[model samples]
Target: MTRDKNKKKPPAVQQEKLNPRELNTEENKHSNHPLLDTASAEIKKYLHDLIEEFKDVLLIQVRQDIKKLIKEMTSPAQENTDGRTEEIRKEREASEEEFKHNLEYMKQIQREYQETQNSIEYWQNALTETKDNLLKLEERFRAYERERKSLLKITRNQKEAILKLEDDKKIHNLRIKNVSEEAGTSKNEIQKIFTEILKQNFPRIAKRNDIQIKEAYRTPATYNQNRSTPRHIIIEIPEIHQKNRILKAARERMQVTYNGKSIKITADLSTQTLKSRREWGEIFQVLKEKNMQPKFIYPSKLSLKINEEIRYFQDKEELWEFVATNPTLQRALKDITEKERKRYQDYSYSGREASVNGADHGMRE
Candidate 1:
């Protein structure tokens, strides 16, 4: 056994134990090794301070740059806002000026329209007044025309009346001349006889006569020469009657005798013989000269023959007196004269028509 034990004896364990100073010294030595200790101290103290200083400088720089950027952006925006406001003001002023010009133009047009209306009114009134004046003038003209027509009618009637009076006077004078010549006496003697006859038949006409009578006698030789034949004595008679009476006396005395007829105191007759027949023609000639024919005195030819038969008795004083006293004969004579005057007047107005009708219906016809 012992032999085996020798082979296994472990080496004696040596345990070293040091003082505190010695242990501290060894620890320091290990920690103070050049690379290890110096490197650690430098990193903690110097490097950490440098990094803090750099971070502060970077923060100050960033703040300054941001302030400058803010000032630059705000200045430009403010200027643009001011410029936009001024532009809007100018546009408003221009619009106001345009509106004022339009208002003035409208007023001018209104004034012109009013003046034109006044002119139209004035012309219309003038036309109305002119029309009224024309109507008044037309009425006056009509009144004047009516008065002129009335005056013309009055003048025509007066003219006809005057013409009728003149004709009666002329006929009366002619009858007086015929009576004086046939009576074979002075005009005064014929006037006296007519006056006496007028006194008996128409006393009014006889009283107005201013006449005288003278005797008339035939020569002895003249009486003896015609003694074998019936004595032809003409007696003077005055024309004292009106025109109508004288015409009637002449008409009553008118005769166509086969033989000699006796002479009435109022009218003369031809001799009582065949040669005396020629005297009847002379009586008709006298009637024609006086513008009185048998047709004019009588309405029909038959009445004219009857009148001639009644006149055969030439010595009928009553018949002669009746003719001398008639009044209508004068009216017939006057009508003839008026017709002649009107014929001439009508010839001037209506030409030939007036003349022809006047002649056909006149007293002379």
Candidate 2:
């Protein structure tokens, strides 16, 4: 029993023993652990604060730099602004100058147009006036032509009348010449016969006046035998009373003298007596009794003749008057007059010699 009790007691008192080196190693590890942990946490907290402060500082510096750059870029420059303003002013001035030039040019063109218009109007008015004058001149020319035609007609009539008058004068002269030739009478003898015829036909003149009769005798015996007779007869009668008597005697004589001759006689009424029908009829009957036929030439024919003569004479007178007024014509006329005088003197001398020779021959015979 004792032994088992002792063993149990011993076993209750026994313990485990550690190594020194291992104990030291484990103590060191434990001792360094608190230091490492504290160091890591301190380092972490320090890094967080440093990062926050650096972020704040960086943001503030960036904002300041951006503001400075903007100020530099956006600021106005005085010199450049002034230059731009001056350039704008110059452009405005140039525009105004161009407008003024254009206005002046337009005004010049308008003035030229107005002047041209005025010239055209003046020319038109002148042309119108000239046309009017020309028309008036044409009218005047037409009037002149009408007047000329009238004058020409008058001239033609006058010429025909003048020719008829000349023919009548020629016929009368021819009749006188023929009668003188046929009678074989001297001018004085014929005149005496005419006077006797007037006295015989004019009873009123024969009764009113005393006529002395004379005759030509070949011998003194014949003269003594016809002592009461005169060689010529003179009847003292007025010309007015003798005219009608002379015409009657001439008609009676013509009937006796031209018994077998183809003789035609005509009596015309005087224009003054034409209105007196009784006087005209009496004259007509007287002419018919003397075997004379009366013919009436148109009054207009006679008037035309007179007018023609007048016109012809007027033209001749105009020419003669002009010539007479000229000194050259006057000298020419004087020369002609002198020449005519010389010719007349020569003819008179020749005629006197011929007359003297004829008288000598008559005395010898």
Look at candidate 1 and tell me the lDDT of residue 332.
32
Listing every candidate in turn, what is its Cα RMSD in Å to the true structure after a full C-alpha superposition? 27.7, 28.9
Q: Write down the lDDT of every candidate, Cα atoms only.
A: 0.44, 0.45
Model 2 ranges with Cα > 4 A deviation: 1-88, 171-365
Across residues 187-243, which tens digit of lDDT does each residue of candidate 2 receive? Answer: 465455444443544455456654332321111122243445322212222342243
lDDT of 1 by residue, 203-287 (tens): 5545766433332332222435434443332333344344345446445646312113322332222123212234234333443
Candidate of highest TM-score? 2
- How many collisions per candidate? 10, 7
